[model samples]
Target: MIERFRAGVLAAALTLLLTGCSAVMVPVSPADSSGLGRETVRVGIAYDSAGRGDKSFNDAAAAGIDRAKQELLIEASEAKTQAETDEARAEALRGLAAGGSNPVIAVGFLYATAVGTVAEEFPGTLFAIIDDDSVTADNVVSLLFSEEQGSYLVGVAAALATRKDRVAFVGGVDVALIHKFEAGYVAGVHSVDPGIRVDVRYLTRPPDFGGFSAPAKGKAAAARLIAGGADVVYAAAGGSGSGVFQAVAAGRKAWAIGVDSDQYATADEAVRSRILTSMLKRVDNGVFQEIQAFVKGDRAGGKKRYDLKVDGVGYATSNQQLGPYQSGMEKARYRILSGAVRVPVS
Candidate 1:
């Protein structure tokens, strides 16, 4: 079963000026006078399925850890998730923790069980998991994001940008987390026009992490939706999203929506124009901030959330083609933030 609750209130906006065809993140060093005795914190990252090259969730988390490495001067070790299993995940985390990785970070919800098991054994090691809050151990911290909120915003963009009143969603996996993205998207499209047609599909089921890695599957899924009259497609399918981008680019009048990072800046130039916008889930910020908090000795175990009101999630504006939908996007964002509209988390 899933749950729903309002996130804490905060105000901020993400503005990136894309000058050289890509967004370069400036390293954020720890502030002066924290008074921590150690000069550097050793971090061990147990990455989610498909590893750092997936160019989606895992990659976003990697960017943050990289920033920490450069700015905080931390010694970090990274390990990718192996076969989807409690034992495999736990062994990976235990290897990191046993190797003196103070803050062992697990990068996905799949590691929830592994993290709980390992954090219990290594009580002194601080553990962090992204997208999973089931663990309540005193030594663990769960960094969660309002993915639905950002998805809703981009859904609005899709609704406003579609030429054929038809949009589609391609999810990496058929799970609760991906369902959150699906549910909010349906609502957003309906909010724009209740009669608009929306198509939804998932690449793979749980225990088979192929959905996040198989770009060929994502491409085929998007192609099917496009053939079925979907002119706009949103992909929350990690590296598999690359396939969706490819499908949309090859189509006649179709557009693609990216997830996690800004595909407009990161995607290939040939397909870049086909990507109207992306639901910017700031995984990098969440990871970096949590690490900073832990460094300051504030590792209280609980859900540390990111949401729309705080700029934790948003839509990419790097593409000039999305300018036409800016006013409506801003209005929808205001509604969501002002409680006039509430995004469902499935």
Candidate 2:
């Protein structure tokens, strides 16, 4: 009955908003003024080869978890390999269920199936899965990213950085989420310079999403795109984006855009110098907020979409990555942030 109530309350709250964490927009309890420390909140991060130290996807999420650990007295651990990802997610859910940990966070959309299976088995356990809407259990809070909007910003930067009106999108896998990035990037370029061309290629077509972690695959894909007239290539592959940077550096005048984290800081010095900019997805902010809510006994649920409307998603710190962009690129960023320009997410 307690589990059912929690699920029902979550469902009722979700239709009112989307996403997990503070973006849920529901009310939050006051700080635990009970003069006692909040018990530990366990967060599970499963990185598929993009792994925790990739300086990008997994790294960004890990930073968020670390923030939560610092802000609140919580326990956190991550799983790097495919097998570990599966086992860790299951173990986290089961353990949290046995305890009363509300909204145990599952980082990365890659854990959709694992989260689904585990969340279902542990109905009483509240879960927040980042970057996926596929899990609809009332007990689950889906954290979907408006990657298109962020991708659009970087697309505009890439378009301006390109000396030859040619850019490319290098993706980890051709999944639906990644497809949105490709479409939005191409659209953003056309939005700026109608004749600008973008080459599209994925490190792995399908069945081998592992390409996201394979630097060699990223290098090959980026090289092919570079050879095909792309003077600027934005790599949406997690760790693979490094390979994209490597290939871009090798090109005559190619630039590479990093995804998930600020490549300017995360990429190797050689690759970092070639970086155009990055799409900053605030996974850390979301993770911190979710843990905060759960710690305070705020158990509300539903899908929460993070996008430009909220800081949940957007282009990264422009820094020097955007210094070379045409004056128009800066204007676009300003317009998007100020509501003068609305970047599409679909």
Candidate 3:
């Protein structure tokens, strides 16, 4: 009977290893001989509501997890969100932790409450949350970014790239978090020339995270802004930002800015020509760094901040047409890092 039970355990472990880590189950593999050969570190990641293919925030986090998988040779598990509610989010975290996936990184601020609730149940598990710093747990580390700083750099680029001296901003949700993007963008545009115009709009309000996924709403908003004579539009609206890219492509002389990831490389070939630049948030680096630290027996806890000075956040230069503005963006970077300019969160 004991031998039958042992065989069952091995069979279950084999099944999980064969199925891959995209789902909730943990991967079972032989331990790495690098240091602790008896145990392999298992890291799990809970992605945001938009899931892994958003080509923005969630994908960036996944990049970090992939890096850890390759370099650390650690076992990994993943859970993608469906409903953005607190209960669903917490349930996802619970699934990963209960499956023996430690150092679970929840990819967005939406996971704060869920992570906090689930972390209490699994005190032995290490938790990391990105874009949220409010969770106060001894085992949880809040990964934050200086998004406003990066937004400011892109704002400067937009100001320089715009031929009409009029730009626009489109946000997915009307939340304080998205407002940070709006505020920094406006400040950056005004920094270049106070007379320049920045038209702004939000697709939806709080509790309606559908805004982030609704590309039609983004297209309508960008279309209206373009009709109003704004030549450059910046979108921080997750997947919905794809619509903004489409709108820019449709507009003959218009430019669109991407957020979270380097949309230039990630965007479709048809729209790549119009993407002026992207705000590089480096979510992947944060995720990988924390997991790497955990694997080294140095578990990272408390707040982990990524800012411009640390290369945690900045603007992309994938398009060569942005050559003229490169010098100015660098100067702006120097000013922000040297305390000559202070970018606001709101």
Backbone clash count, each prediction separately? 0, 5, 0
Cα TM-score of candidate 2: 0.81
Segments of candidate 1 deviating more than 4 angstroms: 1-36
**Number of residue pairs clashing in candidate 3, backbone atoms closer than 3 angstroms, sequence gap of 3 or more or interchain:** 0
lDDT of 1 at 72: 59
Question: Candidate 3, residues 1-346: lDDT per residue as tens digits?
Answer: 9999999999977865764443332222356433332356888899877788999989999999888888777778999876778999998999999998988989888888998899899998889999888889888998888889999999999898888989999998998888889899998888898889999999999778788899999999999999899999999999999999998899968999999999999999999999999999999889888887786565557998899878899888889988999898899999999999999999
Model with the higher lDDT, candidate 1 or 2: 1
lDDT of each residue in 1-346, candidate 2, tens digit only = 9999999989967854543332222243456454223234555555555467888877877888888776675666555543535665566555555555555677677677778887878776678888888878878888777787778777888777778888888888888888878876876787788899888888776666676788899999889888888898888888888888889899848887888877788666666677767888777777777777767665666787767767776666545647666466566656767877665544
- Candidate 3: C-alpha lDDT: 0.88
User: For all the candidates, what are their Cα RMSDs to the real structure?
Assistant: 12.1, 9.2, 7.0
The TM-score-based order of candidates, best leading, equals 3, 1, 2
Q: What is the TM-score of each predicted model, taking all chains together?
A: 0.88, 0.81, 0.88
Please provide, for model 1 over 166-202, each residue's C-alpha lDDT reduced to its tens digit, 9 standing for 90 to 100: 9999999999999989888888888899888999999
**Candidate numbers sorted by lDDT from highest down:** 3, 1, 2
Which residue ranges in model 3 land beyond 4 Å of their true spot? 1-37
Candidate 2: residue 64 lDDT (0-100)? 80
Candidate with top lDDT is: 3
Against the reference, the lDDT scores of all candidates come to 0.86, 0.73, 0.88
Clashing pairs in 1: none
